[model samples]
Target: MDSYTSAAVDGHLLTPVTRKPPLRSSADRHGPISKLGDDLLVAILIRLPNARSAFLCKSVCKRWSSLISTSAAVSFITVNRAGSTTAANNLL
Candidate 1:
């Protein structure tokens, strides 16, 4: 019994198992993912539930900071709605 116990203690049978890395964070770039280009980033932001998250992405970095500030996105939205210009101007 002592020899059996010693053998088991020195063998792989007593070794602890290591866990695999978590997968969800690796696969999903859902929000504020790193290394994204500006155009693709805007596409992701548009899919968010609302404009607040879109605007918050600006603080992520300098490139993102500038991309959201441009008139292109605003133009895209305004074109979709004719009255957007007047409403946006009022907000400004």
Candidate 2:
């Protein structure tokens, strides 16, 4: 049979532990969002509620800014380059 006892000091009880848990690395703490590709990032940013929200996402990092700017340009060109002149005029 094995037995152990806890020591009490100042009305608090303390127990002995065999080992402490390992500390997490900075990358592990931040998770995998940084690992997403530019295409996926652009798709996510496009789903933001409005232009202001999308612009806010741009300030998150330099990479995000580049992706957001590129996606916005592509979207603008696509909208303005349509065959229908009425659709282009209505945008203005």
Candidate 3:
């Protein structure tokens, strides 16, 4: 298995690679989720087993705190996405 891949491999001696973590973008360094819009975030949060679990995720950061605080925004969209009477009711 001889190939010119990462510069970290220098003749079989496994050198420690000191590479920075992959960034979502140069402007936003928070994380991949931080880059998502409110609707998208709500979609993801709604899948957290139950509302309490989803609500607790607000402690993760200010953006989440603000978003989760707005229950109408998250609930309204979550209901629509559920698209079933029982599923929508379960969201409550």
Candidate 4:
């Protein structure tokens, strides 16, 4: 060790830095479904009772919406379903 460092340690001039781990919220305690893989999420969504149910489910959660869009979910269930117009861009 360098003389300065050794002297500093001997004199307790440098205190060790302590770091605390990030805290998890209550949602982390019981929401295990969020941990589902994308394939599983899509599969489960694709098996809904009907296209309506699938479309409704798409807005259930942000993650759910991200995993499956309303039209995508409906199309997955109804292979021959007709297409709809594109959604307009969201403006501020």
Highest lDDT against the true fold, candidate = 3
The C-alpha local distance difference test score for the whole of candidate 2 amounts to 0.58
On residues 1-92, what C-alpha lDDT tens digit does candidate 3 reach at each position?
A: 35445655645654455898786663276756667776666666765665677667879888788888886855754554433344444544
TM-score of model 3 (CA atoms) = 0.50
To one decimal, what is the Cα RMSD in angstroms of model 2 from the true structure?
9.4
By summed lDDT, the worst window of 10 consecutive residues in model 1 runs over 76-85
lDDT tens readout by residue for model 4, 9-35:
655776456799887864585388877
**lDDT tens string, model 2, 1-92?**
13336466557666666887798875575578777766555555544555566667778877677776785545743443324345334443
lDDT of each: 0.56, 0.58, 0.63, 0.56
Off-target runs (Cα >4 Å) in candidate 4 are 1-30, 70-74, 80-92
Q: Any idea how many clashes model 2 has?
A: 0
Q: Which residue ranges in model 3 land beyond 4 Å of their true spot? A: 1-27, 74-92
Clashing pairs in 2: none
Per-residue alpha-carbon lDDT of candidate 1 for residues 5-87, written as tens digits (9 for 90 to 100): 44365344554458997666522645446556555555555555456666787787666777777888645433423333443
Instruction: Single out the weakest 10-residue window by summed lDDT for candidate 2.
Output: 76-85
Superior by TM-score: candidate 1 or candidate 3? 3
> What value does the lDDT take at residue 88 in candidate 2?
38
